[model samples]
Target: MKLTAASIATLPPRKLPYPDSLLPGLALYVGAKRRTWLLRYRSGGGKQVHDKIGYFIPNAPEGSESLGLAAAREKAREILGRVEAGVPVAEAPIHHPKTGGETVEQSLDKYEKYRTRQGGRIKSLPKTMKALRSALADYATLPVANFTRRDLRRAAEVIADRGSVHAASAFLRYAGPWLKWLVERELIETNFARDVSKPAAVKKRKRVLSDEEIRLVWTAAGSMEGVRRDAAKNYGRAVQLLMLTGQRLDEVISLKYGDILDGKWRLKGEHNKSGRDHVVTFSKTALKIIGTGEADQRVFPGVHGKISGFSRLKKDLDKLSATSGWRLHDLRRTLFTRLVEDLDFPEEIAHAVCNHKQQGLSAVYNQASRERQKAKAWEAWDDRLRVILATEKVVTLAKPLTGLN
Candidate 1:
């Protein structure tokens, strides 16, 4: 039904929005204490946007702030015209109440508070906010309203140059939503970061460590010493555990004595990337390295919570090991590759041992735990690693063991 003044007056407060018959995108949001006018439309990038037009006042005099039904339709049309002309609703010359010229840094603080109020369930929120502040440090004092697309692009470029394309991409990925949040609150005129082009994709890394490199790393990790000797040794042990178990870096470091039972490391859903409980059988060597501990005790505690000073420790490891161009994650890829190629283990079993989620139809129907197969594969890989370490002479292969093409 077309919204008339009388009809709107009779309309009760509803949880769902009420659409206007005359205007396609115009709607009325009836709340218990107030009513609002909203204009819903799609952006040029196919993103759906609900632009708040204004509040509704039943019997306000002419030139009042609150818009009536007829006035709201007119306002919606005006906004729609600008939007259709390639201007974002945020960028349109609409008068919104100022947020007292909040600076980017202040806005960031507010955003953090907002996320905290929402329960802060996102594990990476803190890191993401830190990166944003670091990337946009130059604009910290600048008002959020003045932050532009060019500025956001420049920030991304700076991050890419200083770090990696991946880092820049991550910054943009977080910034876009944050800018949109500012726009939603009428604090900014536009979500300038939304349309900024991401840095060109970098080649995916496939670096897998060779047997000789693995031996070097193991030896170097064991020999690490400095002022923080105990912490360094703990980090080294954690690195070795990564090689042995093929688990993610975060999951391995987060290991507690309670997580290990009966020669198996049981990872809770929260700790696992797949958000499901996973069990990985431990080799005798891995168990020995883990040693004994109370159920509540951390196996490898660092100065704070878990291992820290990764960059310095990794640099030392690289120098001592005399190996370059490989990451800790490479150890996982190396294990999976060796299991499948050298031992002729089934890909499915290898995947299970790695705790990789299945793909396609297999993910939908294949609920088999494959625990027995995973255990067998783990034992075989453990034996292979022992052999690789025991050999005194490094067998020079005809081809380099960099990665599979």
Candidate 2:
């Protein structure tokens, strides 16, 4: 019978192979665990070979490891062509001795554990693993030994075609190091992903919202409405806090009332990107926005954890504020720039306010929080921001807007 996707879905598990009438030598075997596609053909040596093509999915999408009926047929034809030409073909279900017969997905699991033990960035591991999984989805079930440079290139191309060259490049960055680790452990003979050309480098964003743009965004965030009004308000408050404190978005959104004490917000090492405890003194305006909350409760409570749906929230915010080409991170950048450029605050104080990591000998010895200096900077910023928000006309400065300090 013709092997249709619907027919394949209902096929019962049996010891016998169900042959496909449409594709010569192509068959499906429905085992208790999985349905797999196979090609049965006679080799040049007159030996009958049962070549396993791949597993079968009723309707597998593009880039899936599992093959649909159409994809299976195509693979079967390719194998048969090689068989006819007397060319050697690698058998499916490859078991490499060095890798202990582990698949790509299995190796990735081991890699994650190894990296964690080696002191990999705790906060970034999940995101890196997630990107690698997505980029290598088509090869997840294949043995690590079977992965080739061609396969890495194909995976990157797939991601690039989907519209994010930056994501494609990032995939290579993550995968290359992991593949190299496999090589060092003798799991694979070579790092196949090492030489894959990445997409062009993305330009670093230098966008900083002007005072007028800041005011517009601040006003629009406060006046948000509709079904997601509460969530929107929470996100808006987080944005405003980012602008006020020059703190990272994740740090702001993940804030808990317990972290704040005596008008100073403290961030634990694990909760921040720097992996060092950070403390920032809050201005009166920032404190009012945070208000009073239970010690354990989140300042901006999300449905699950920290507030999400940022892309949608940002789109709505852009529409409402009449702002474009600016990111939430730009708020943090704007704060730092305004502090140093307009307010004449020293660069070191601005760095303290942003909790930027120091370098060289200073990084090892300097443990000072610089609380007094940071508080003074925040006070000056608060005054400047209030003036910007209150004015109806856009304030254009001919030179540095100094003297607030």
Please report the candidate that would top TM-score against the real structure. 2
- The TM-score obtained by model 1 is 0.66
- Local distance difference test, each candidate: 0.78, 0.80
Q: Write the per-residue lDDT of candidate 1 for residues 1-405, one digit (tens) a residue.
A: 568877886688999889999889999988876677889998888888888878774543334355788889998898889878987566444443222278889999999888778752455678889999998887776667656677788888888887689989989999977898898999867887768888778677898888788888877766665544377778878888888878888778888999888988877655555545678888888888899899988898887778777887787777767787898888889989999999999888878878886678987788877777888888888889899889887633222121110
lDDT of 2 at 96: 19
Per-residue lDDT value at 323 in model 2: 78
Clashes of each: 0, 0
Top candidate, metric lDDT: 2
Task: Quantify how close model 1 is to the true structure by its C-alpha RMSD in Å.
Answer: 14.8
Candidate 2 local distance difference test against the native? 0.80
Model 2: per-residue Cα lDDT at residue 14: 95
Q: How well is each residue in 1-405 modelled by candidate 2, as lDDT tens digits?
A: 567877987798999888999988899998876787878999888999887888764433344455778888988888888888889877657331222267788889999999899873477788889999988887787767656677788889889999899899899989988999999988778887767888666778899888789888887776554344367778778788888888988778878999899999877766677666777889999999999899998998765667878897787777777778998888878999999999999998898888887888878898887888999999899999999998878633222211111
Q: How many backbone clashes does candidate 2 have?
A: 0
Q: Where is model 1 more than 4 Å wrong at Cα? A: 1-103, 113-121, 141-146, 176-194, 227-229, 357-368, 394-405
Ten-residue segment with the worst summed lDDT in candidate 2?
396-405
